[model samples]
Target: MATEALAVRQAVPGDFAGWLPLWHGYNEFYGRAGDSAPPASLTEATWERFFDGMEPMEALVAELEGRLVGLAHIIFHRNTGLVGPTCYLQDLFAAPEIRGRGIGRALIEGVYARARAAGARRVYWHTHESNAVAQRLYDGVAERSGFIVYRQDL
Candidate 1:
């Protein structure tokens, strides 16, 4: 699928300047509302890892006129008991003003393409239940699995 106006591609180190805003916007949408600091060193390491072909983690970005408006982060992990490899879409965020303009769709489609290339049978992600707008988009692209995920901070 060709994204004409929205260019979707793997993120590079130099893209961090563009990514930072979109990333924060995404986190804010999740109700982590206030500014949260991500160490510069860790952010640099993430950008480096995405370009490191040896790593299973990957990231994609959507650019319009050389400005980033959206991004997607994907992680490949093996599932237990023959569940096979799964691609988890860790994050998907688009600038609020740019929402519904295909940037988000392009980001998702790019993740699907990457996951397919990696031999993944399925791709999955989660969103806050109250995020109806996002859920609408997600519903159009993929089915919501029946299981609910739980976690506890160790």
Candidate 2:
């Protein structure tokens, strides 16, 4: 596959149909599918966020041969450690068959470009400890912060 030909761009309203499957696959990879899946309300809100100018969330899609092959959702927020906003790449996924072909890298790089344009100080994201394949790619592009994440449901 010639990854050089693929294009990454901000997602548009017409992309919802193609982006849905990729969204489900991403959630399933994280054990959030089927009975444990998020409610439709949450999904709707997420999609809405991408189109809402008032929201700091944005989504990028990878297109090749007129087909959507990947998706990345990014969020810009203020952080106490930085004077500028930080970009949080909340979700990233490339089609199973297209993994390792540079689609993921393109999407991440796309996010980085967008962050830079938005005056964000940094772009960061986390993956499951078991996702070594993804880690290999991530390691090449960004340094790991060595910070452990902790969370509790209220």
Candidate 3:
């Protein structure tokens, strides 16, 4: 931040080189260590979509000295009884070494800005029940809905 080093820009195919590690790190933090990531094919497809200009998925990367240090993936989804599509923050991550250095905050703030620009009625995301580190930051930036998420594979 000495020189305002972080720049959040729309991700492109070429950014895959910088984003893959952060993406994997994000997944790992969610407790998926092995065979837990979206298939490589899906990752490839996602990279392509980020630059397609027509896809609803949007991603931004935070770069410093031309190196990607953080990322945020966002999407708009329909919600019944909502006045407009809700903006969901699908993922947010920063390099472990750079965490608490405000990079993660920057990525999330960027997501908020994108959502507002897209005319979204609201923006939100969920973290694991025990993710204390993320919760600390989430508590500061947004209100907790007190909802417990349930998931079933297959």
Compare the candidates by TM-score and give the number of the best one: 2
Model 1 earns a TM-score of 0.86
Q: For model 3, where is the 10-residue window of minimal lDDT?
A: 1-10
lDDT agreement with native, every candidate: 0.83, 0.94, 0.84
Deviation in Å, model 2, residue 88 alpha carbon: 0.5
Give per-residue lDDT, candidate 1, residue 152. 100
Q: How would you encode candidate 1's per-residue C-alpha lDDT over 31-98 as one tens digit per residue?
A: 65445655567667877878888888888999987788889999999977336678999989988887
**TM-score for every candidate vs. truth?**
0.86, 0.97, 0.90
* Runs with alpha carbons beyond 4 Å of true place in candidate 1: 1-3, 33-41, 81-84
The alpha-carbon root-mean-square deviation between model 1 and the true structure, to one decimal in Å, is: 2.7
Clashing pairs in 2: none
Backbone clashes per model, in order?
A: 0, 0, 0
Decreasing lDDT order of the candidates = 2, 3, 1
Cα lDDT of model 2 by residue, 1-154, tens digit: 7987899999998999999999999999899999999888988899999999999999999998888999999999999999999999999999998887999999999999999999998999989899999999999999999999999999
